[model samples]
Target chain A: MPELTARAAPPLAHHFVDMRQQTEAARLGMWLFLASEVLLFTGLFTAYSIYRYLYAGVFEEASRKGVELWAGTTNTFVLITSSLTVALAIHFARLGRGKLAAALLGVSLLLGCAFLGIKAIEYANHFHEGQLPGKFYTFAEVQGPGASMFFTLYFIMTGLHGLHVIAGMTVLAVMAVRAWREEFGPEHYAPIEIAGLYWHLVDLIWIFLYPLLYLI
Target chain B: MPNGEHQTALEPHHGAGRYVAVWVALCALTVGTLLASRLSLGPPWHLLVALAIAAAKAGLVALFFMHLWDQPGVNRLVFATSLVFVALLIGLVLLDSATRFPLANPPNERTLRFEPPSFETHVQPGEREQGEPGAIGRPPARE
Candidate 1:
């Protein structure tokens, strides 16, 4: 029934009444999907949390011995800044200045790329150090693989997040181009706003992940 | 999206200053969390505090930057649902992990007695064949 209604949207979707409805519905849906995603990763986070709770020293040792604390911290900064760009982009869109909006989005896209590039370096360092996964880890300084699970989760969560960063970059880039052509304004700025929401959610997820994987 | 739920104008939700403000706030919050990470808030609190701060930052982004504040009232419901479900999944999973611990203790010296030992193992098959005590072993760490 919901699908029917969502499909009923004007040749666009069933859930919306107009383009505004479509945009809002889609944005809301994205957030909802993200919520599910948050939970999905929560499983891995929960595992990491429990083990770290029980073996605080192991988790701490793993962070120090295996994880790239510096790189993780740097990526944290990059993500937040990218989020700022997207947010500002939305603001520019609201002001009916498509060109400036697009420019801000471009900045966001660039920062997002920078984040992935930095992440690649972090992953490369991890790989070079043989912090792969499971029994394959080779942290020469660590006690054993017990602490490596932290790294394992660290990689998985951050890797998944990196993928999202890439995805958000693509979305922002496309929207930036469209926005530059004046496809959005006060009445048609939903895409820019939606993109901002998604980007922020990505940042939000990482906010929790950063402390878990890097700090605590 | 255009619908007739109480019909409203698609007026813009943010201004240039608002955009800048959200960005500034986001930066401040990110720096705050980074600094907060330096603090040893203890187990869940570390995650909790970081997330709380992140949420505040994200709220600034969402409300000001994304202009979700003016989009539609229903969108908030969507956000709520997503958050609730995510929380549920986290709650359920953590409940399982947390409850399992008190019911059992890991065997002290990485042993392979009962279940498949959960920790890492350094296996020396030759030494094990020679009845070496350290051959193929681990600390009992799984709950």
Candidate 2:
């Protein structure tokens, strides 16, 4: 593929290079997309920080008791392992191993489901304990009532991430089906790679969230 | 919509091992950040360290996880512009929050009796005399 020039007979993605240009273009788009994601989550992180500052003691105590560090840790490991598998999927796809890539993608999806299932259990427990935010929170251990704020952010942030996990799983499922069909090959596997990128970001966010919510 | 426009369909990425290495580095950084948070660091340092780690993690994700590092600089420029915009957005928000109260002048009158409509769901199950409809939503976490 010619550098920066439209090919007269381009077999590349309509918006990209021959395979080379397409890869670069797609990579660029993912970064821009990720930038947007960073900004989106930045709002939540900022809010959490400011709130923690104002109620440091309360949040500390809540952090110490309100959340299960083990649960969060397990989830973190789940995500990171899935990230590894997704990375492997991309690796295999690069080697033109579509079936393996698809299989790994499926494994990642299962792990994602496991993560969500754990998240659901955690959320349900919080709700049962009335660990929600605002005035409604009623956990016996969260003294000063202001501690509800921590749980509020906890639920909202993790809940949002859980939703993303669901979305990611749907994407993985589709890719797995495509891989099974032998659609992605030496010529086409960008979807798997992009999906890998998205999954990694999800894992990265959890890495931060785990400590923020669990470790004081 | 075009074939190349979306990366969803394509051949494998080059330098796959490099991206994998970056991902491992990211995992290490995550553990480091968690350890750093446990120290009795001052408030500013605590935030600084955490944010630094976050920046590193985000960089790794962007560079390798997303392969932006391998792409042309045009994409980087676009991504950077959005960063600036996001900073601006956050700055404006901080300014609004910081200046909510007058430093010098005292308020002539403040109303405690009148209830403001809340964006969050009612925190309590029962309704009070001043039942505000707007308050019926999830309680937004301030932190």
Model 2: per-residue Cα lDDT over A3-32, one tens digit each: 112322324656653776676667667767
Residues B1-143, candidate 2, lDDT per residue (tens digit)? 13344454443255557656775776687678767877858856876687678777767766665556655468678777877876776677656644654322221112222356354543445544457544545566589
| Runs of candidate 2 exceeding 4 Å displacement | A1-33, B1-20, B95-143
Highest lDDT scorer: 2
The ten-residue window of minimal lDDT in model 2 chain B covers B103-112
Give fnat of each prediction, in order: 0.50, 0.21
* Number of the top DockQ candidate: 1
Docking class of predicted structure 1: acceptable
Task: Give candidate 1 misplaced runs (Cα > 4 Å).
Answer: A1-19, B1-8, B41-48, B101-143
TM-score on alpha carbons, each prediction: 0.75, 0.73
Candidate 1, lDDT over the whole model:
0.68
Q: How does residue A161 of candidate 2 score in lDDT?
A: 82
